[model samples]
Target: MGAVTPPDGFTFDGLVAKLAAHLRARGSLTDARWEEALRAVPRHLFAPAAAWFTSNHASAPRGRFALDDEPAAWWTAVYADTSVVLQTDDGAGDPLSGKGLFSSSVSAPGIVFPFLELLAPQKGDRILEIGTGSGWTAALLSWAAGANSVISIEVDPEMAARAAANLRKAGSAAQLVVGDGVKGWPEQAPFDRVHVTVGVSDIPMAWIEQTRPGGVIVLPWHAGGLVGHQLRLKVVNETTAVGRFHGTASYMMLREQRYNTRWSGHHHEAAHRSTTRISPRTFWDMDLGAQLLCIALVPRVSWYDVSEDGGDSLLLYELDDHAAEGSWAACDLKAGAAEAEVTQYGDRRLWDELSSAYRQWISLGRPGYDRFGLTVDPAGIQLWLDHPSARTWKMQT
Candidate 1:
């Protein structure tokens, strides 16, 4: 790799170099080949002309930045270690318009390199990449695995086209397919690795079937309705894959696997109401370990918290509701109160399940997220602590 010339009308004054050094210092850009790829594939070339900025995952996007409109700010954000939202509400609404979900983004350098490190693609390795959001990671994978070794799938046709153009301009030979990534691109089966860029609630068996034995699949596992986890699984055979969690990662949920966030309009006239000694903070303030355990023990739920009336309130929504339609729960933590009021509006009693999961986690010695591992097979996915067989529970498939 020689000197990388910046795109026309853009001046990257060692910014990629600076970004590389930053990732290295942060211990994410450890591989020499990956570092070279980072230098070769300038992120600016892949970034969109207009995008939204957010300081961190916890904060909402501040405002929009356009390359032609705000060159300096756009350049700075492109080089900095933060995600840039490419579209919101599936391109129907502006990101900063105050009412739209973040549908696409160029993930921060911090998260991207870590997953790439976990992928560890080898030269000439056939790689299948899910969610070719900005085409940046695909380019990097092509650089690592050599030309024509990467096949990337994107669900959104518009995003796919944009990514295809970006890959072409970046000189990456990675093939781009505009289709649902959950299906795993069967035409190109037996891939050496599967790299997912979106959050997956359920591990698609198609991925396992497409991957060659001993192949690795790395993704952001969305579970427990909390912040996701970095999951790295090795295909043990045709029917099974097992791996452990690396750390916390949050990404946009895969479109096909996305949970319904809209409130189900049902009058809770006869809904069960109760009180619990468990405070709302117990749910909202749970560390990553507890959150991961809850994901295993109390699967198929999403939660959100709010500060209200000088206290915290936690709301749980059912994602896999079947018999008990629209099961939901709300727990309120009044300041300086020992017990919290709980309300259940469906048959599933989500709050009770959450409390039970929390107690189970406590009884198991409060293991951290690192101690847990996932086993995905034809029967179902299972979560275990310490060892694969040591205390396992079937996760909602």
Candidate 2:
């Protein structure tokens, strides 16, 4: 086969320079070393020949753009500050034909640089990276901390093979392993840094065991809910890792740690009917910290909103696959209304729990995500306000 042609009037050096400038202007690509790496590595090399571009509003990719067919569009996407999906539904569906959940992707540069800034790996630091994705992150890590010092793990064999090939083509010698990320590569135990590209509900003890004391493990953490926060934890000891939320970012959940919920979808026969002084907009307009607090306080609840001629309302469902019992709550919130009507069913009153958590969040001065921190150990994780010892809530496994 002959070599593929680059986009007309496109140069690698010029594209990299533009991408670097874009990231720097956004305040994400602050580190000089990371910027240099971004300029050096070619993102298109790691992306698939045909990839899907994602946006905030769309459920699946808007559509797939092929390199050979739409070279200019493909080149633009590669350099854009948005995520490009590589695989969909675990490679089960045809991404080019239909819509499906993104399985793996080259993350947006905006989030990628923030993660690298939080990681702050040194020259010779040993790093273990989870969810290798398109190998772009591994290549960047190698460029920053030496290719020989990085070991990246991917659960899917196909993704692993592709990532390895991409790394080799980029001349990066970062070691790529095909295995479960949750088990964490114990063979390379006591790494100075561990970076997880996927979102996790729980902090695995294996990760703590594999990280050296005082080492940093940066991961996107959520409490079994839709929204997630970036956690930057430092291994305090063999059994403990403590850190605070730096910011919020949505990531593909770790395959092993993905949560599946069974909803009964019965909302008419609620046992209790009441009204709340809280407006429907309270939850709808909640900040990241308050949103996370709701998940922390009321575990295993999935929330959504419905629009109708009567009014806009929020629904909360208790997700228990084994029980499959009808436990749900709804709040009918009308515009300009002083109060909202709430109805609860089954054993758990989800709306009441959410309201209580929201009140507590307000009582705490409505702290942002940066004020909340987590401590993980064999005893389970603790979500605290302000500091580690201050008022804390024990997280459900």
Candidate 3:
């Protein structure tokens, strides 16, 4: 990859224009309004003076780039279509130390634009945005819809304060509320749209109740795993909302909705051990939609980890519902091995269920994200393949 040149004069406006042009050239800024919004709201104003660059395996940030120390690098990062980490370890650890999980961030333009495109905001539309990280998305929403028509909620007070300052700096008048987003903001009910920036384990009923009957809700939905799917649900009536997966992406889970109980390093004596011809790659190499199908087929099973034993041998763990009394399963595979060893403990056979789900997915012609849809109603959430009338899997209540 070649280095991104700082715009002539290295001015903020120059950088903004350059970024907008880049996004347009890359086909991410296809919508004229969204392109204009990108031009209007400068990302640098919302990004922290000192921000961290993150990678997939990075537990913590490798280091921080201070604008004062490296203006060119900082400007390039802020303008680049990539996510910049703002906080780590739930805002408890040193980001420069390179040793914590990312808590908050300015999502990359690549992911952000698809969401805005799917949202398809219109003039005079009232929008409610969840997860006001860095206030960039809120500012974008304000630009898409009039500033007075958008309300953004954040859970962290400090983050909220920073977002408020950023919004003010960007001259955005969008409302910023510091509160849990799971409840949705009812004071401004019947909103035409609801956009959740954070990943949610379940579709909150509050969001459904607060939206107008015909309103749309766009969010990164993940049951209990790493990868998340983008869902664009339309409120059909007071009790139901249905939609199909528009795309695949991942985001940090909402703080209040995070799962606390997790599998620890322990092997149960009652674990049933067996060998199967199924390669571990069946689950490992699945696309985002297939991974999600595994979750839907076996609700409450979460992908744990994959470990290598200093050689070609690999171990994969899948944990059952956190509250399921430590139920878990592990599969051992070796290079060039024809069969993989599988072990299951606790009340549920997670591996068996996963294998069955994989076979079922194959029978369905290995559908993509667009082939699946979700229905939320009074009873519970249902995952359907092809159409709602097709085979459906009921999620745990």
State every prediction's TM-score relative to the real structure.
0.90, 0.92, 0.89
lDDT (C-alpha, whole model) for all candidates: 0.82, 0.81, 0.77
Q: Give lDDT for model 2.
A: 0.81
User: In candidate 1, what are the lDDT values of residues 183-206, reduced to their tens digit?
Assistant: 889997899999999998889999
Residue-level error in angstroms, candidate 2, position 115 = 0.6
**Model 1 residue 339 lDDT?**
80
List candidate 1 stretches off by more than 4 Å: 1-13, 24-27, 57-62, 95-99, 262-268, 320-325
Angstrom error at residue 10, model 3: 3.1
Worst 10 residues of 2 by lDDT: 54-63
Q: Residue-wise lDDT of candidate 2 within 82-144, one digit each (tens)?
A: 688878889997656547767898998888889999999988999999999989999888888
Q: Which candidate would rank higher by TM-score, 2 or 3?
A: 2
**TM-score winner, 1 or 2:** 2
How accurate locally is residue 158 in candidate 3, as Cα lDDT from 0 to 100? 87
TM-score order of candidates, best first?
2, 1, 3
User: What is the C-alpha lDDT profile of model 3 across 1-397, one tens digit per residue?
Assistant: 1223344458766766776677777666788777677768877778777778653222322346667778677777777776788788788977555557778899888679888988888889999999999999998988888859999999999899989998888899999999989999989888999999998877888899888998999999878544678889999886799898876778987886665435543556778999988866556557766776777877766654464762122232443334435657777776667787887876677778878987888887888867889999888899998888898888873
lDDT of 3 at 360: 82
